[model samples]
Target: MSLVKRIRDISVATLNDKIENAEDPVRFIDKYLQTQKRKLTELEKLYQQTLTHAHSVKQQFMEAESNRIKRENQAEVAVKAGEEQLAKLILLEKMQSEEKSEQYRLLYEDGKQTILELEEQIQNLKDEVQELVDKRAFYEAKIESIRLQKQLNQVNRFIEKQNYYDQSRSIDQKFSELEMQTNALREVRSNDTKTGSSFGGKLQSEVDAQFQQLKKKLEKER
Candidate 1:
């Protein structure tokens, strides 16, 4: 397998970029969404590549380990058969394979870590995009509510002005009833003024008021 260049720092912090040409909240959200999508797509592709590279490294490590073990077994058989020269050559090959395995193992581990970080970055981007979508929804609702409330206020003002005569007529009728009650009370107080603040006289005057009302009713009938 061809050697791959190491992927350095892959942080979501690096994903942040200024959104341009946005006029309003919604537009800002739109532009931000576009940028995030593009970043997510690229990150995902990178993740796949990283995954494939890690697998390649793992395969190489396994192959090198297998070769080392095979050579070690072959060397042991050669030594048992009294072929010391052959055993030395096999042992040397085994050492080379062992070293290669160690190197590949380290690379595979590094690749795995890179893949994890890439996955984390992708998820973070997705979460941020979702958060922005929620904010856009909230902003849209608030903007629409403001527009509706303005229209409602205007309509209510016009309708309230239209109802002025009706409300005033009702108020005037109540005022006239209050005025009548006030005049009756004034008449009572004036009539009681000559009674010299006598409680019994005031009580008797109130009692006589009912009879006066009955007499007025009888007069009306006649």
Candidate 2:
């Protein structure tokens, strides 16, 4: 199939998709409503044509019925005139007229049924178009709600990030304060470590010299 045909086929297949998946469903509904109006116009035109055809068929049927009745009356008159052969001929003609009338009557009846069916179809189409309009409105509302939720989510994220930034700033300020306190305490304890390490360094030097002297004496003995 061609592209146009494919699009038309898809449009027909998912007639409701026009509303359900529409980005702007209200606009879509408006367009669909216009399309339906045009379709209704076309259906009306065809309906008028069908009605005209039915009317013509009915008129023809009436004429045939009238002819049949006239033939029967003529036949009756002929019979009363004491003309037996002519009466028989007139009766035969009357029978033919009746058959023709019956055929026309059947045609008229069939046309009437067809016209009724068309009217029903047109009504059904109109109802479906209304359903489309209602559904489009519903979906459009849903879309707006979803969009609002997404916007809310975005705003919430921004607020959360802002809160995180505020917390980080507070933590940084606390750490800086702790660092200042730690430096002050270390300055106060600096004299204590200097005195302790001075004594410790002298004791370690004496122990090392004594061990070396003992090692020398043992080597000399060996």
TM-score for each predicted model, relative to the true structure: 0.63, 0.61
**Sliding window of 10 residues with minimal summed lDDT for model 1:** 1-10
Give the per-residue lDDT digits (tens) of candidate 2, residues 126-145.
77677777776787788799
Model 2 scores a TM of 0.61
| Candidate 2, pairs of clashing residues | none
- The positional error of residue 21 in candidate 1, measured at the CA in angstroms, is 15
Model 2 segments beyond 4 Å from truth? 1-40, 85-89, 174-222
The TM-score of candidate 1 is 0.63
Tens digits of per-residue lDDT, candidate 1, 154-193, equal 9999999879978999999999999999999999998887
Residue-level lDDT for 166 in candidate 2? 100
lDDT of 2 at 168: 100
